[model samples]
Target: MTDETRTSALQILRTLVGSPTADFHEGQYEAISSLVDGHSRALVVQRTGWGKSAVYFVATLLLRQRGGGPTVLVSPLLALMRDQISAAERAGVRAVAINSTNAHEWGDVVAALERDEVDVLLVSPERLNNPTFREQQLPALVARMGLLVVDEAHCISDWGHDFRPDYRRLRDLIAQMPSGVPVLATTATANSRVVADIAEQLGGAEVVTIRGPLARASLRLGVLRLPDSKTRLGWLLSHLGDLPGSGIIYTLTVSAAEDTARLLRDAGHAVRAYTGQTDTGEREESEGMLKRNEVKALVATSALGMGFDKPDLGFVVHLGAPSSPVAYYQQVGRAGRATENADVLLLPGTEDRDIWQYFATASMPDQARAERILSALERERPTSTPALEALVDIRRTPLELLLKVLDVDGAVRRVQGGWVATGEPWTYDAERYSRIAAERVAEQQHMIEYETTTSCRMEFLQRTLDDETAAPCGRCDNCAGAWYPTAIAADAAASAASSLDRVGVAIEPRAQWPTGADRLGLPVKGRIAAAERPLEGRALARLTDLGWGGTLRELFAPGSPDAPASAALIAACVRVLAGWGWKERPAAIVTMPSRRHPQLIESVAAGLSQAGRLPHLGSLEYLKGGPEGEPGGNSAYRLAGVWGRIGVPDALADDLAGLAATKPDSPILLIDDLVDSRWTITVASRALRQSGAAGVLPFALAVVR
Candidate 1:
């Protein structure tokens, strides 16, 4: 607005970019002015690498110069926080973060904030509700806060692709902030509905929304539909090196990422797997390696999606299509940020829809489960998550997520001991949730349309983001006719097939009983007795594997008949058993009773017994059928459901009892079609060992992690 203010902002911008000619982008100047000069709430929806961080950094500097307190920045991911901290330092702004990784340094960070030394403080949304931090440190910071920034703010709206419950807590923070404190929410991918929702949550009608064009002219987008996983891997193995520079290869599942990365590395290419299961330290290392171009690519999942910054990334290849066009746009935006030309390709799989449905269902809260949780909390004192899991029928992961949603909705509060009911009237909005679910299904269909569309791929993505300026880019394969090669070499295809077809997954035994199991009337307590537990088991493949996952899904789908194991799957199971490397070879194979797939289990056991030259001692039959309901729930409930259901038949008892006399310490190989909670195997093995069997070793066709 004023000459002096412009000059100061421009001076800081130069330092931020390390260039004397650096200036704000299209909407950066407006956002900065609104936050600094106007002291107003603003929401900026711009494409990635469009200087969103610059607006906040410049505004924070200006506010600090005016003797304001430290700016509190709520960033979603640790990777993003790391990048923002580095950028802030480049501009001579004192920046630090209080996250899970840097717990040892929190006291020093708090001291700096107390002394007014921190120019900007970046924190994860989960930290906002930390008991000690919220009650002690956060209040002081909020009282003197100059500005509040929400990075990846699309997460605040449930309609966004990556909805996070922790992010919704920021609404209370915004409401509690001192009056006149400017708040800025920034995101690269937000449709009109999501943008409106975020603005409403921020300041309701008064929130200033500045949306820019969502087109990325530098990207050459394309879609290549391969027949199967092997062909897709073949195409990647053949053409990945041809891309401009080091970039990312995203997969829909962690197993796919790891398998792809392993295949690439084995072929003398530098690559690594980055996923949610990756260790924190290793994830940081992988990020640095990718940023420095030390590796050609990081095969990843959505874990590396938002807030990862690499300006010159040359390509982004999706091994499987994302569920929504908006999500695809966000991930592909990582490429061509600071390059003249970058390649983007989508390899959509038939199995993508199934994965989409699994994740989408996981995101929606179950009304009945929510009501159960609330009712349980109402009658009790503060209850810990472990204790609650034994009482409720939900698993730990979904239970914790549901608790967060309930906490933010004011139906519950997390206290020092645990969670307690707030007695607030909370209604289950089934209508809104159903609408969101329907919207998700629509997005999945839209993704299918994106793959099939012959029009400009860039235009399709831009339109998905609700950009009114959507048009042909004249660069995508659909517009320009296939810039990427589709040919796959014979040798490469063979190698990929071999790599993908290889299958064997270790099934770790359930070493300890879940907490509070005793309260559920089960004698099991902390550590499961070693003698009663089944030895470390082996599975032919994971149910979520990139190779065998599809076949297993079809076999396990509801209403699917009980059929014998296929020749190829049985052969794979034999290979898994061959590579088992157990301390003692089993003298007999015992199958578990499967109400749904009895033929499948017996077929697998008979095949393995014939191959290994071991006796097929028949299956453990259920006294009164198997467990009620489907497999899944807390450990105590699952164990209770399975206990006493399976037992060794009298016909097999004589042979099992003779194992001690014939082959002193030989193990009995307990075979099953699948393993979910491992409780059935645990109970069955316990029954066998109690019947004079020396030991029990479990083997399964597939493992559900």
Candidate 2:
């Protein structure tokens, strides 16, 4: 049986790679043999480009040839699914994918499955929870599945760097599989903890764990400490061209990615920004461009991580270090997959910790908020997320995440309409959460150590991942004495400085009232009235911007003193106004009464008014100490908190009326210290417009993205 399987697998492997001499890597054949011959569950923790996909594809065709059922592959990303399907086709296996993007083709896929034409079926973890697919298809698939494959399986472990709530549902799926059905889970990023967790979840002591050394022989690792974002950009400007081939330049935030991409393009480099905010079609196009080496590099955030297969990628450069060394290893593993040499460089920034903290907390479920969500859904009927938001204080993103966690915990169940409490009596695992948090802190410290370590960088990363065979590679900067250039060209430094100095971000006005406002007992609904809407406004910078973000973060940090704007900030605000390109100058300036930063808001209004030579019309009256709630709530709740809480004073009303009579086309500039929900600005603008202002132009010092 083993010899026959080997011959068959080698044939498929050669066909898959288009090479007659192609054969299995050291552990690939073992993984396949365990599944096909032993019919046992297996976990393959290998580096990227190790042909983990090949194990499953080869096993799948062999199983089907023996009259077994098709393989069900749970993949993570659309790009990955596309690549897998193409590879399966090369091996003469019919593959189909069911994901959000290709819902229209799901019926065709189902038809093909029924006809026994599909040898492999790929679906995302989220698809396992889809109402129709879960109820209508999963049970039947589980009954007949020849081999169950979980790609990027580290996501199933909470301790993993990129854990997904949806992936935890795999435990239920695994439990439901028919007895003797072989299972295979594969990942390129998993430390010892993650591997143990995944192995236990896959099937406990019966599972065969296969792990290889986590080191890339072709990767030359290095770290270059840069003082600020401008200097980092200068280094890239000076040295990007000198790197190998088309690669990735990773940033910590969306704004930074876009900013870096723009700067690189301005410097005549062929590059584009890829982030979560990028359109789906454009993301596909960008991936294609990068794979074909049509561009020099892609400026991207972590959204570009995992399942992006680019053999011979040449290099991977981090504009800011990731929070954990494991994550760094996973990202850098993307390079040198099938090449003799690839460059992996890290440019650690001062703001990296802040960014890491923000993301780390964003993923953890808050105990209080989770309890509130459960309490809101304890009623008899199913409640949609928006309706639940009206009843609870949590924002949409976090609220949805909490719901998924509860769903996985068996405390809540999603139905056709929305979600319902399962009455399963769930308890928050505070101890476990605390331990995970502590582990995260330790991992962050390890990442810092990795940046400053005098020891071998590659070996340090391997040890962080708990690779037993970790040893010095004699290749990284620390071991080989800086294989990368460190000098920044004078012209490149000037260009980077100029790019950072350029400021002004447009604040798009909120055009529509958030849905479920009526549930919150708010009168407003549907599109905001055109006349009441504020004109497109301007901000000095986004709170996430690579340039001004650090200063703004410090200024608005909790417990920070609320003082008047600094001379430099005031000047930056003036620069924003000068470059605004408004249709007409403002007739007067109106300030939003601030609860925390009254002095700051007033000073910015005064400074801009003085600079523009416009009359300062005083501040709007706060009916109830300004808006009720704090920052970071959903739009409906945020608007509800602000509605009827701001009023146009009689004096300011008369002043605006007088200005409207004299300068009918001119708008009243409304200034605020910060904009988060934008509901405050919308409400304030409506009040000013109702009080006889020709129009309102909203302005803010910074925007919280």
Candidate 3:
């Protein structure tokens, strides 16, 4: 960056250092400026305190200044909404939060919003659900919603950091909006899956992802492996030794937060702790006092979030590892907001890992079984606690998770009277049957891959679960290490054209998994690569790839052989692969939508050959915006595919080292669909050559529109 940008960034960092938040870095401002200046929607998949709120806040200001429609910040909490409104007011923007909890003020807020008088409209999803907001004011509110800012957006994804039903309903909310009012989503932490899911849910908006650097150059990151609570408490007191400004200590449980706060206060340090379960007046008093510096440290549960913006918080001490890395990142991120040299103390207790893993790897009750259990409870009338326990294998805790899901889906209700099924009886049984077999198999396969793979641990993870499709993933653990793909000793006994002989294989003898089977532990099997009906899933996939022709029923019919042999042959291979812990389902395969290849094809082809995951990357769309973004293709896959058709080696995977050695003008070409962000391909290819490929190339269908 230029001197001006650098100077401004450091100044902001300096200004916010003593407050209690660790956001407002130079990089955050630059990223936010770039995104707002671009005037487009983006997914901010950043860690906490990377100034995510400031980004949206600044974007709102810019849009207002530019006469954009009233910026709608869809915050989840009423308190957070009010805070944003207050912040905006501090900057002199006409911000208002339409919280109708009081009922009396609801109409006034609605009328103000209808007239587009509000510059930024912050409202909870529940507020949006009201009949008044839905039927009257909501319908007309969108044309004025030039910037649809979805704050804390992950609640929408089932696989998000935190899943809430109200959040999922926002999908319908966006669908109800007036067209062309671009939606911009901001979140403190989102992984790769969350990123793709966000883009997909947001109606295919281009992802202007700003991955804030995870390193806090100024903050000292120290993880103390504590043996017990006594030692951890001692460490905390020692660290607190007269660092004047302020610090925040986080605990996983409300009781812990309270106890810690109590002990610290008793020891003569002004301390405060807050939990979601804390009483209203007491909670307010605690927060207010903490903010005023009456309390030198605030011990809090994970219940705190983006609403509070305190700069210059000197340090953040964690009692233990959080539920997820994302949580830890966001919490520590709250520290050093203004401290150029801030510190993050991560006390990953030994018990923390085991405790957290108990939740993570616990055998989840079958989704269907849980649904049925609740349905039974609902239909048969609310039974007594003992009666309910006796009727089913469930206890209160796991039941609570599913109950939460059911509650969100509006499938169940809790009344003073008892639990009752609400809304229509959603038919989960049909969907359940369609998934069970495949889900079991797929999950097993993923486990097998992870445990069996000879490749770099980071590489396997990045590719298998993380799915970083871009050519260059230099920042990942895999890109930093050597890769050694396992040479799965292909049993040469079975020739390529030989039938998958299944002679003497147990027909229904047993369902026992073999030794290595435990390793491939994903949830689904075979993706139904070739199913018996509807003919859409893995069934269509296998047929298309194997270059076979037949109806789904006929193919799966009893006694029918696949391709060149008997059903027995193919069944044998399935058994063998299963025993070896191969993915019971066919791996994710692909087909390009562009059946109409250009006679005088539009692609620039060179050095493109598919390999590694090249085959899985699917087809490249040769479009300058005719259509983009299918179920599987992202800009990364689209780029690789376009390069694939350009006569580049199809083995065009994410190995940057191999691609960098190519001569610039050689006949060898690398092609992709298009370059919305040329940096992905450019970086990928640069790394490949850096590894050792000398005959590399570049090609694509079109430049991004």
Candidate 4:
């Protein structure tokens, strides 16, 4: 390249970095040169905050100055896109994004693109598959694209810690690009395997990989093996304030994040909960709040993991170990990016394994379930997700996820009517998927070793990333010997115990009946009738709640013996009742027969009846056998499993009639050991309403969310 062009690129880099003093990192210039001068595909694997953005931004400016088309950046998260847009604007690069959250602005963005006003066009990976966008906007962008930049590129590879199926569509996008259009894929978390896989996907023989050292000298990592959840909560409550600056608290589940945020807030910390359940607006606000140091921390799940740029983040504390060391490295890398000496701590829990196992298979498509769904979706008529659920035995969550995988794989097509089976033949690669699952198991074990290892934590994480330059830094608890507190104050422990012991989660009634229930011979569809629906119910706690969750999990775990409700659980249930804000109190109690935990349900019913001065009007009887519904699965299948299995027994009907005669419009409380899918309660309540009950209010020991 000519020195004049190099000087111009450096000028753009200076503007992008916001400081004339700032210069390119080790391989930043090389990557930028490759994309601009050579116009070659490059893969840059460097540490977080290593200015991956600068390389693209500078290259985009230089290329645009040379009369090239706008750079098309395929970002993974909306949050990341927002950050990139802001950074690009600061560099005087006109950038705009087209994502789910900004449909209203698409026209303006398109106009800007047509006017050649946009230097960088940011889009999510999922946007590539959008029918309207793909059919129209995307093809134009691809044809005129100057540079195709894939951020968090490891997501394209199944071997990566956080593999996203949507990212796999990038291969097609890359192939569609003009030969001379330079493509750059960047990530901080890929190991050799993931790197190789991503490079192969990018372009087998043409990809240029630029890797750098992964060690972070500013990060001081450590792990605390708390005996249990309560103790771990206590430790966090006590020491969260002691951390260096405003930062994040990572949790394994949404409930944990919420619970921890609430407890920490009650203790006078300004914190907020962030999870996949959090709305996009709130997530954006929370990210801004964290960036500006308006909140102490965002107690978040992996939803807040990638593309969140906060350079001065003080610390990152994990309530439970992440499933993979590579993932842990990515999260903890969020801290100490531009700062010196940031704290990173992990409070490993026994429950971590269970949580890990739950998520490990989240993306692994089930072969039988996939086949069933494909077979159910006739080619002639496209089937809506709900209708398909009714036709297939798969649950809604996994089923929807599987459909996306299938849609990306070309096995199915989502059209106006819904999803329809494509004529293309698809075979589930059982061996590859099984091997990936096994790799995940190994990764989980590697995380365990990360927590327990008596060596430099940073070095261990670096090694996990396959960084050749990984070596011990004179930091971390292992090297420095206990840089954090080991004790939880008595008052803090008491506060944490109180927070965790508190239980009660509102159970929302199913507003709409599962679609195609009529086709299943049940004659139910669309919105459930208000008269037949159970009132907004209450459960002692959600099965996912940090408080009472562990105990309930133990009680409901497979092979757990059915037993009477314990005094503590009964008290907790009573507390849930006391807090219940029903207009009219229940005058009678009817237990839902538990085929698995009859004694437990009976004991809870008996206790509530005795304590609340309500009549115990016998249990609802199963006519032939219990409802076919098991604990888990999609709503339609679960409803089908339990449909017509439960009925109001004669004695219960007689008692209800007599009670109605005495006190008309009296509500009857239905007790059950657990509520999952809520179909059992729905079907049972409909039966009671048909049998002349004024109102049915369902209560359960736990709600399986």
Candidate 5:
């Protein structure tokens, strides 16, 4: 590199960080120089807050100064893109991003790109597959692209902790880029296998990798094995204020995140819940609040994991262990980035493995389901996801994932309207998928060992990531004795127990029939008739709740004895009814015919009937031997399977008619053991309402979340 090039890069770095004395970290300058001067692909695998972004930003400015075209950067999340845009402004570089949230600004962004006004253009990997963008904007951008940057590059490798199928599209993007265009892939968490995989994808034997030690000296790690969820909540309620500065508290599920936030706020702590379910505007607001220390913490799920940049974050506490040590390391790495010391604690629960197992297999495609989808698309026409759901029973999420995998493998193509087959012969790679599943199991076991290991926690995590610089940090709880309090105040424990003991979740009735029901030979379409709709109902609790969730999971677990509702559960059902606050009391009780848990449903209905003095009406008869489809399917398929399968029996219909004549305003309480898709409740409630009941109030023991 020439002296002038080095001098200019250093100046840009100082301006980017707003520090006159700021210089490159150990490998930052080398990575930048390789990309800018050598014009070659480079991969930087370093710990979090190690200035990985600096390499790309500096390289971008240099390439632009040499009269190169705008740099194209592929980032994973909107939060990350927002942060990078702000950093680019600090360095006097114009950065624009095109994502789902900013459809209104695409025209201006494209104009700016055409005018050669953009310095860096940030886009998500998913955007690469957009029919319009790929056909209209991508070709021009690739033709003159000066540099390409892939942030969170670990996601590209299937062996990585968080593998995303969209990232696999980057291989084709790289192959189509002009030959001299420098490419940089950066990540904070990657073991040897993932690193090699990403490097091979970038360009085997041609991609230069600059790796550094994965240890974060500023983080003090520890683990606390709590007995149960209640105690964990109590610990937080008692000691959250004791953690140094505003930080994050991670949970395994969205319900847990919201529940924890509520309990902590009731204890007078300023906190907010963040999850994938949170509105985009609210998520952005919460991110700002955490960055400015306006709130004590953001109770969040993995949705808040990547692309969030908080330099002085004080601590991170996990309510449950993540499934893998690599994932845990990435989450904890968020803390102590630019501070002298930040506390990291894990309060693992006994149910952690159960939660892990629930999510572990969700991403893998099923061979039978894949073949069914392919066969459906063989008709040579476009089929939207909802329409396709009527043809095949896969749920929306896993179906989308399968389509992306098929798209990458050349088996199918997602066009403007929907998806179409490529007529390419595709075989299920059972060997590869099974190996990946086995790796996941191994990772879960390692996470358990991490929670109980007597060795240094930081060292254990570093070694888990295959860092050669792993050693005792001498600052973790195991190394220097526990730095956090273990005792939970009696009052705090009582408060937590009370919160957990509380039950009742509102069951919002489905307002509209799913689109494409006609494709399944059902006449339903558009908005459901208001008169046929069930009144707002209640469930004892969500299957994912921290408190009642555990009990419900055990009661409804696969292979569990199909017995009557226990006394405690019956009492809980009464509590839910007591707090329902319905405008008018239910005039009678009815149960949905259940194939799996008839005893449980009947017992609950009978108990509620005896307690409330309401007559128990017979269950709705199953017309076709109960609902056909199993649990866990898309709305369209679920609704189709149960559409006409439930009918009001002759005796039940007559009794409801008589009750309606006596009390025209009262509703019939319909009970069930569990509510998954809510289609069964909808179908049954419509039958009751049509059979003379003024309204139907659906009640369930648990609602699947």
Candidate 6:
């Protein structure tokens, strides 16, 4: 790095360390500050407690003080925005967060900006696309913008920690701003590829990387090699502090999160769980307990707890092996932040690799399956599951599995009534994700290799990242324990060899549904109130009468941190009805407007779709993930959006006309699931003729909207 760039990077961290709000350790400050310099746009690639947020917040304040036009911070989460703004305000910097929460209060922010009275402004990404904000307000105000900071910049790069195609547009928006308005992007983890992608999108901005030694000297790292999830859970309880400080247990699934939390509570921990499914209060309470040391541990999925800070957190233990090393590092880094002597534990089981493989591969639809979906859509018609079953020639088992992949990708939606296409068909672009996700997955594989190797685990990580240490990292379990280099060395070698011999991860095996599962495909026609009910039986029966007509799988919700699991079961049943081609409907979708910020909607959509299900988290997953303007999964947001806008047969007919008027290429009517709604086809056909979406064909299966 040039001396000037090196100095500039150093100064950013130094400035934060020197701030009245903080006096971080010299080395820690250096490590964090080192990220600031010449990288016009960079993802920080560290964990929550690594002081990454401080690095950027300080940058904002500094830029503002230097007469930088008010800095614009697009936070991925409302909580993160509030936290940063609160911290900035405490440090005597004027910052305000504008969101749907205080819809009317925005006048003050506008007044302050007009008066040049504010130093920083924080907003969720959706706020940027707001029709009024985009056309009328921001153009004039941001014209004088000094700096643009995207807190979770990963959202912008398809390769970064998170992938959001819509996020890719930020680069274009930022580049259009007046020349002097610099952009700073930061994340906890981004490999060389993700960094490169971000830079490429950022008008060819240069990247300045600050990856220091991997070893946390004062923190102890331990690995528990167990045989299965059950045994691992037992081990976690044994290690439980039996104290108030919060610890988190990482699980692979939302259902797992619920199950684990129940197990812990039954074991007498007064514990709670958070996933993409828990209620807002539940999530908030779980976190609150952690911050207040009211609960000793929390069970959650991999994506939870970004931008959450709890100094003096005693430990972070993973009940599962995360898919990648970057994820592991981020998860474990949660501990040892407020003090030395904190611990991080990872409980590895036999199927750990299998689980990782499931996420990576299951996420990518098989080529043949993708092709089938495309062919069906090209014909401008929605096919039933049975129809798809014939086309793909797979046993019902594998066909069901492929269906989930399509559902997650927004290619299809399901409901109590049937299923239909919300948008275009599935198109695989290996260049879009495989390379980046592989690199991310490989990093985790490398960690497994390193841990299994005879050499010290800490030493391996440190030596790889910082490149100076050949000596052992005496602090790790391997370095101090009996499993050191002897037999482990041989095993790790074999593991690496086997890893190289295999093909990349593939889709997960299908989960078994009930024998008499009544189902449908998208293009649902029903009342939104169907999903709003809490009774599974009523929901199912109502959906069936509306149009649903397929055998559904066993409905099982292990816990109810949100509503009774019964309510969730009904929602699931209704979705089955919608996804199976019940009818084209929208009113049957928006039972209620979004009660949370925007970000949660994103996470819910992405999380559900990732699981090979549709993104209709409804009240259950919505409260669990957070609201709009909160950081969430891309898959979830899209699903919720489609589901939210769904209407009845009449409404679907109207929207069909509306969309046709918009003239979507090869326009087709969307349905969640399908039943035999008489009005659906006739009304849809009339609407298509009226508005003119070329080759208009309504699509759905086990009907959902």
lDDT of 5 by residue, 1-705 (tens): 788999999999999999999988999888988998899999999999999988888999999999999999999888889999998999989999999999999999999999999999999998999889999999999999999999999899875423578898899999998899999999998989889999999998999999999989999888988899989999999999999898999999999999999999998999999999999999999999999999999999998887688989999999998998878888888898889999999999878888888887777878999999999996478888878877788888888889888888889988889999999999998997888898889889889899889999888888888999999999999999999999999999999999998899999999999877888889989999999999999999999999999999998889998899999999999999999999999999999888889899999888998999989988889897778878758888889889888999899989988998899999999998888888889989999999999998999999999
Compared with the true structure, model 3 gives a TM-score of 0.51
Candidate 2 per-residue C-alpha lDDT over 514-625 given as tens digits, one digit per residue, 9 for 90 to 100: 8888888998889999999999999899989988877899989889999998998899889999899999888889998888898889888878888899889899988966
Q: What's the lDDT of the predicted structure labeled candidate 3?
A: 0.49
Q: Give the clash count for each candidate.
A: 0, 0, 83, 2, 0, 146
Clashing residue pairs in candidate 5, if any?
A: none
Q: Which ten residues in a row have the lowest lDDT in candidate 3?
A: 532-541
Between 1 and 5, whose lDDT is larger?
Answer: 5
Summarize candidate 4's per-residue lDDT along 1-705 as a digit string, tens digits. 689988888888888877887778999989988999999999999999898999999999999999999999999888888889999988999999998888999999999999999999998887888778888888898889999999999889885423567898888888898889999999998999899999999898899999999998999888989888889999988888888889999999999999999999999999999999999889989999999999999999999988899999999999999888878988998998998879999999888898888777666788998999888988878888878888887787778788888888899987776888897999998887888898888888899889888888888888888898999988899998999999999999999999999878888888898876777788788898988989989998877888799899989998999999899889889999999999889889998887789889888988898889888988888866777745667777788778888898888888888988988878899998888888889999999988889899999889877
| Local accuracy by lDDT, each model | 0.89, 0.90, 0.49, 0.88, 0.91, 0.51
Best by lDDT: 5
- List TM-score per model, in order: 0.98, 0.98, 0.51, 0.97, 0.98, 0.57
User: Alpha carbon lDDT of residue 244, candidate 1?
Assistant: 82
Q: In model 1, what lDDT does residue 367 have? A: 91
Give candidate 6's whole-model lDDT. 0.51
Quote the lDDT for 179 in model 4. Answer: 88
Deviating ranges (above 4 Å) for candidate 3: 1-39, 46-50, 61-68, 77-79, 98-107, 130-137, 158-163, 357-404, 407-705
Tens digits of per-residue lDDT for model 3 on 615-675?
2333333343333323122222333333322211244433322333332322122333323
Tell me how far the alpha carbon of residue 606 in candidate 3 is from the true structure, in angstroms, after superposition: 86
The residue-by-residue lDDT of candidate 6 on 349-452, one tens digit each, is: 55556457646664444677666654554233556665554344343544555554455455664432234565764676667556766675666677687557
